[model samples]
Target: MKRVAIFLSVLMLVSASLSYQFYGLPYLQKVDDFTLTDHNGKKVKLSDFRDKIVLVFFGYTFCPDVCPATMLRIKETLENLGDYKKYVKVLFISVDPERDTPEKLKEYVNFYDKDGTIIGLTGTPEEIKKVARSFRAFYEKVPVKDNPEVGYLMDHTAYIYLLDNRGLLKLIYSPRKDNPKRIAEDIIQMIKLLKMEK
Candidate 1:
C-alpha cells in the first residue's frame, strides 16, 4: 500500500509537470485587448476576434526576407487547415508604422492572401509600441548606410503568437523550427481542447 501510494503521487506530479510545460494552461499569458487600424482603414480590436483562434505576427511590408517567408508559411498553414480555416484568424501587425500605411498594408497582404481573409494592421507609433509591449515583441529601427532610396530597416522578433478563442495566448512558434503542417495540427488540437472545456 505504501509503494502504491508513492507511485501514484509521482505519477500525478509528472503528469502536472508535463501539462504545464507542454500544454500552456493556467499559466499562459492572457493578451490584453488592443485596437489598431486594419488594412481596410477600419479600427479593429483584439476582442473582436474572441471567437477565433488568432495567429498574431509582427513584421513590416518592406522586409526583404523574413516577413514575406513567414507570411507565406502562415498562408500555407491556413491552406493546411482546409475546412477548419474558417475558425482561425491571422493578424499581420506591421512594426514599421511610419511607412506601413493602411493602403500599403492592404496591397502587401493582398499579394499573399487573395481571399482577403488575412488582416494587415498598422497604427500610430505609440499605439504600435503599446501593442508590441503587450506581446513582449521587440522591434528597432536601423538606418541603412549609403542607401539613398532603400532607407532604413526594422529589426524585429520573428516569433508567431497563437491566441485561444478567448484572447489568451497559448503558444509561440518559430518559423525556423515549426512548419505550417505542425502549426495546423496544433490549431486543430487547440480547437478540440477548447471544445472539451465547454
Candidate 2:
C-alpha cells in the first residue's frame, strides 16, 4: 500500500511537470533535433528555427478536407498576428512523404502563401516517422477503390502545435474551432511572452 501510494504521488508530479513544461513553466520535453527537406528542397533542421515561435502541423496534401481547412485556419491566424509576424513561423510537415515530393509540397505551400510565411516539408518515410513519433503524431493510410495507384486517403492527427521561440511546446488547437480569432489571440500572447523572455 505504501509503495502504491508513493507511485501515485510520483505519477501526479510527473504529469504536472510535463504540463508545465509544454505550457511554458519550463518543464516540457523539447523535441530532438531532426533534418528534413522543405518544400523548396532546402534542408531544414528542427533546431534551425530556434528563437522563432513555430506552429507545426502534421498532415498530407491529399487529405480530403481536414488538412486543407486546418492549413487555411493556420494562415488566417498568422495573418491575424499582424506586425508580430517577424517572430513566428508556420510549418506543415507531410506524413506521407512517399507521395509528397519536395516539388509537389512546394507548390501546395505556395498556393497558400506567396511570400512564404508557411513552409511545407517532406522526407524519407523513416525520417518522417521518426519526427512524427517525437511529436506524438499518428498517421495512417486508408485505401480507396478508385485510386489504387496513389493511396486514396490518410487519417492523421488534426491538432496544431504552438511552440515557443525555443521550440518548447505550448498549446494544441483543433482544426474546427468556433472562432479562429481566439487561436490567433493565443498565438499573439505566446509571441509576446516569448519576446519578453528574450
Q: Candidate 1 regions off by >4 Å?
A: 1-27, 196-198
How accurate locally, in lDDT, is each candidate?
0.84, 0.75
Give candidate 2's total backbone clashes. Answer: 2
Total clashes, candidate 1?
0
RMSD of 1: 7.1
Candidate 2, pairs of clashing residues: 21-27, 21-28
Q: Taking the tens digit of each residue's C-alpha lDDT, what string does model 1 give over 114-151?
A: 88669999999999999999999999999998996888
Q: What is the C-alpha RMSD of each candidate to the true structure, in Å?
A: 7.1, 6.8
Expressed as tens digits, the lDDT of each residue in 117-176 for candidate 2 is 788999999998999998899998778888677646888998887766556665677655
Report how far residue 131 has shifted in candidate 1, in Å: 0.3
Q: Cα lDDT for residue 179, model 2?
A: 44
lDDT score, candidate 1: 0.84
